[model samples]
Target: MVTIKDIAREADVSPSTVSRVLSNKKDFFNPATAAKVRKIAKKLGYRKNTLAANLVKKKNNIIVVVISSVETNFSDQIIKGIQSEAQGIGYDIMYMYTHTTNEEEHKHILETLISRQISGILFVSVILEKENITLLDAAKIPYIFVSIKPDNEHMVIGSDDQEIGYLATKYLINLGHKIIGLAGVDAYPYAGFSRIKGYQRALDEFGIEANEKYIFYGDYSYNSGSQAIKYYHENFSSLTGIVAASDSCATGILNYAYDHKIKIPEEYSIITIDGTNLCNITRPRLTSVTQNFRKMGSLGVRKLIKLMEGKVNTKNKSIFVPVKIDVRSSTARLTR
Candidate 1:
């Protein structure tokens, strides 16, 4: 709780001089004096009252990040990106998680954020409802959606999910596998549905008739992957390849296959989305279409900062980061 007054007294200087030196107002003091004040402040364990300073400035240099409850494998990487960018620009980040899609809860979160006078918001895989949008609009709070694309027009930053699907499916197709199954893809209007469409597009382009039975719709969870394998085993035995919705889902499939004595890459070639570290740790390893999640996070913060600074451009409303495929042992050419 040592204050500027304590440091000033120790340095034998006025409080205002200490304040300017500590705040980096260099025009008022020389480097030597500034260094002396800083040294003394460090010695005395002095801490600045950021809350009081922000109150006087009428703005908080804090950004709130809202994350969905269904945390993905790459979420930590995204947060790392956000933290690196925000820290470089002297802004602090606060995190809040939304465990449910309840509108009342969303409203409460929004109200709490507004009350804190946060500079902006970054949403990670959380879709905003109409009421939540209205509240943000009325409050004039800038927000950028990350990892999930909302239905309406807004600031969004994520990988091209459709391209990811297309790339994954096409990779399997190029390996001479026409019978490919899709696992753990949801029908929700997000990455899952878009990826499904991409899967269909690749199938149509390659003249492979897509069988509805090959599609297993489920959330991108490990359990979903296991259930998908069970469903495919029962209904689509002729499938030679499978595209999973996530790395975790792919791992689940691998585990299930091991338990059921299904040979990987020989009996079933699997390609998963989200090229996270989990892909590398699996037994056979997973080949995956990798999304630039870290780039998405850092770019989202940059875009939100632009919006908060009133530099909004009508043309740059959405940003789609690129996706790439990582070759691994889980996938091989159709050699049956």
Candidate 2:
């Protein structure tokens, strides 16, 4: 281990002088002495320990944003938000990726954050269950939740899921499709439930019965969407429309219909959420509910910074961004 004593001996200075110079104590050394100390420290390969410095300061300018999964398009946007805010505020960022495998990793991540003295943490769209919350509480660091959520606990900001669901379904309902379906998967986190509720809200508004069979749940993957379509085809006899919670899932639906010889809109219509550029590249440009993730992510960072600075309050201090549906080739009036 390289010690201050070694560097001081090499520099021909007292350990106290070395410490004062390395800590950048302004008045402790004259310019000539400071210059000699700097040269000696450099020659000795001495580097200031950021962790030790942060410990003495009792807080860190470093903020770590941890996400459970990084595969989603929207999660990327949340990251963009964090990076933007950190850059603007001049805070260092340590990005942590924790794949959803176990409860222990979440605990480990939290403990590691405290051990390193991370000032704040931003959780983007991945729910931290009770055990994980207990871990965070033990860490005692301020945290802000972004995108994915469970009812009121930490500071959260994301697009309004209820309105998003209502809008997509309402769009289909307005297009005169009577047999609209809400596509979901239990493993997809909160998107499934929220989108289904949105679909139900639209159905209730139209005085239609909330058919349980029309609600299909599968994994929220493109392949899952393909499987979901097959399930719907076999079960829902007269399904004319489907609203997928994810654009990736919707892309799956598009491929399934094309491959299985089912007509889209002429036979069925589908809409998805999170209008990433990928939607435009698909065979039939997908109609989707668009939320600007870059903006969302940037705003999350701003909010987190405010919270860290005591400029923002936690209770009743959430930001709900609006969402818009992008109409494209995949959706059409229920023909045939």
C-alpha lDDT score of every prediction, in listed order: 0.87, 0.78
Candidate that scores best on TM-score? 1
In model 1, state the lDDT of residue 76.
78
Name the regions of candidate 2 deviating beyond 4 angstroms.
1-24, 30-49, 55-60, 99-104, 187-189
Give the Å error, residue 168, model 2: 0.7
Q: Can you write out model 2's per-residue Cα lDDT over 151-261, one digit (the tens) per residue?
A: 565667887777788898899888888888877545454656776777789999999888988777765568767877888888877888888868778878889989999
Question: Can you tell me which runs of candidate 1 are displaced by over 4 Å?
Answer: 8-21, 24-37, 100-102, 314-316
RMSD of 1: 2.5
**Pairs of residues at least 3 apart in sequence or in different chains that clash in candidate 2:** 81-297, 81-298, 125-148, 185-218, 265-268
Weakest ten-residue segment in model 2 by summed lDDT: 184-193
